[model samples]
Every structure is written in structure tokens, then in C-alpha cells.
Target: MSTTPQRLMLTRTDGSPISALVVDDEAVLAEMVSMALRYEGWTVTTAGDGASAIAAARECRPDIVILDVMLPDLSGLEVLLRLRKLNPALPVLMLTAKDSVEDRIAGLTAGGDDYVTKPFSIEEVVLRLRALLRRAGITTDDGDSQLVVGDLVLDEDSHEVARDGESVTLTSTEFELLRFLMHNPKRVLSKAQILDRVWDYDFGGRSNIVELYISYLRRKIDDGREPMIHTVRGAGYVLKPAR
Candidate 1:
């Protein structure tokens, strides 16, 4: 519920093509990181220090960034703070050698959405980056919505929801999940798929978070009308306009 928009967008290509800045003082590792991102169809730019990273971020305005915490000229945290001032919506993934709980907490508190520790697998890093992007509302498709299913009409850009032509209030998470379901109406989404696509994490992989949120959505979207969201029992949930 306290999630902030990280502002990541995915491209249509099977490759997760994106523009990303990699900031690491170690030239070899910097090049390696850049190459991995490039392998995913991403455009890679490298900066040897925090100062250069900030400058590049301003110039390039990339969709996401990979920042090394131990930069020569400036720390990654400092760079993150300054960069957010420049573009608060910028998505930053911190790279750290420490792997300590304190470091992770600091990075998230200082504005980085996610992090990868030193000597990480290219595949895991890519997955985490994609997860971050998905949570930020980016996907392989480019679709924005402003319409109704049943009596509920939702406007995404405006963060407005209406039932029977009357507006309704919803938490940010609820609103986002509803938008996702509405966009893919009549598609039965399994809980695992929904967890991956919507919540963006495994989250123990057995929690009822999805069911709980769906219940919240039903209350707001179908409290006084024919249910638009239906459970398939052992399968998952689907949103369809009443026939």
C-alpha cells in the first residue's frame, strides 16, 4: 500500500529493451553490467563515478538506472538523493557489495526501488529489473484505459474510479490491480500468474494477498451490483461484464 511508482516501461521486443545507466567505479564490472543489460536489448551507458552518473541521468533520462553504492566521487545514496531531486520518478536499482540489512534499508529509504548484490547472476538481475518495471506499471504492451465494465468505469491517468456513473475511492494497490484486470477482461489469471504480474514478487508464494485484494476490489466494484469478478475455484479470478 505504501508503494511508490518507479516509472519503468517495457518494450514490445522479447528482449526487455530499455535505456539504463550503469554507474560503477570498477571498469570491468561496469562493462559487464552494461553488457548484461545490452544482452536484454537494453541500451547501456556507463559512468565511472557518481558525478558522471548524475550528469548522464540528466542528459539521457533513461527508464532505469543501476548505481554502485561505493562510487569514487560520490556515494550511490548521495547520487540517488540528488537524482531524485532532478527526476523523482526515475527508477534506480542500487548495486552494493555489503549485502547487509542496513545497506538494503538505506537504499530503499533513500529512494532506490531495488538492489542487486555483488557477483550476482545476470539472469536474476534481469528478472528483478523486470519485476521492478512491472510493478511500476510498464509492460510489453502499451495500453492506457478510460472506460467501463459493468457499472464501473476507471480512468488510470486521473486515478479516478466510478461505479454506475458515481465515483468511488480505492487504495492505490486496489486501483492498480483493478486496472490490470479490467485491461485484460475475461482472461482467467491464475494466482501464481497474478502474483508475478501484479504483486511483482513471490511473497512466500502461498499467501492469500491476492484473494484479500480481490475481495476488496469486489466490494468497491460490485458491492451493489451484479458481480463483475468471478472465481474459477481451483483456477483464479476473471473480470467479465455481466451477460
Candidate 2:
């Protein structure tokens, strides 16, 4: 039982697709973030340094920005100042390796709407961007926010899950796993695919971790009800509307 995953699309108040500018000196990191944003149905532009970042921002007028605190040419703070001049109310999220209290304070004081330290998960970045968009009065194209398959429901905005109208509490990791499965309902996802998407990195031969989390989901999502999550023998796993 496999099918194409439905794309979750978010757009501006005017119905135009949301856009983002990601500025990081690390080319790979910028690409990863861009890919994640595009997956959410957003248009993404990337810049590797402060000079190009400012230029791209001027051209694209992105709805939001993901800025790195350190850059080869200009400090992220300097870039932030320049960007603010372009759009005072623009939402900016700072990414820094500095996690000290003072460093965090500095980024906030410089007008960053949110701050994320290095070594962060891609999911965290996505979640933070969603919150920023919401606070800025942007919203999904449709009024709907919940992902539904049968009686199971997962609310992206509130981070809540319910099965047959009953709440199901899940740890962050479990929730990410379930969200991945739910995103591709009825699709047989291999262990490698799950590890890459859910974990956001190579798990290095740790397929058992996927099995463990699947069991955890089964306990919460399938227990005491017609099973919706299914294993596809050697291929992988699939989730479908329970019959």
C-alpha cells in the first residue's frame, strides 16, 4: 500500500507562496535548509555570505530569513542591521554556534525574531519558522492545520495528536517519526528513508532505532483500535486508513 505523499502548502495572506532567504557560509548547510523549506511548499533563495545575502534579500524580499551569526565578510549582526533597514518588520531567525546567555541576548537585541544554536535539528528549524510565520500573520493556504488519516489526527501548529477523538501524548522523537509516516500515508517507507528524514542525518547502521519507534507508535496509534500502521515485510512500513 503505497502512494504519493500530499504536500503541505503554506502561503502569504495574499495567496502567493511564502518565500525564504537562507544565509550561511556553509554551502551544504544552506542547501539542506533550503531543501527543507522547499519541501514545505516555499520558495527558497540561498546566500553564502553577508554581501550576497543582502543583495538576495533586496531582490527576493523574502517573507523571512534564516541568518548565520558568523560570516566571512560581515558579522551576522551587521547583516541584520542592513536587512532591517530594508524591511524593519522582517522576521529573522539567527543561527549561531554561540549558546551562552550573553550571546543569545546579543542576537535578540539585534532584532532577531528567534535564535537557534548550531547542531540543531532540521525539524526544529521548520517548527520555529512556522511559529514565526504565524506570529507575523501568515498562514496556511487552507484553514486546515491538522493532518488526518481516518480517525487519527496530528496538529502541526499545536503539536498535538489525537486518535478517535482521544489525545495521544508522544515524545518529540516519536512525534517526528509519526509525522514522517503520516506525511506519506499508505507509502511503504524503507528503514533508510525513515532514518534520513526523521533523524535528519545518517544513523550509521542503526535501523533498529526505527523499529523501536515504530513499536512505540503502534502502541499509541494502533492499540485498542483497528491497526492503521502496517509493516511491508522486507520493504518497510506503511500507514493507511484503518478499515
Whose lDDT is greatest here? Answer: 2
TM-score of each: 0.52, 0.85
Off by over 4 Å in 2: 1-8, 140-144, 196-206
Model 2 lDDT per residue over 128-163, tens place: 898898788876435345678777888877789999
Clash count list over all predictions: 0, 0
Residue by residue across 1-243, what tens digits does model 1's lDDT show?
111211233463455557788889999888877887776667888899988988998898877788889988888899999989998887888989997999999999999999888877554566677666656654453332254566667765567998778788999889868876775677888888777766677789775999999999988888878788899989999988865
lDDT of each: 0.78, 0.88
**Cand. 2 Cα-lDDT:** 0.88
What is the Å distance of residue 136 in model 1 from its true position? 1.4
Candidate 1 least-lDDT 10 residues: 1-10
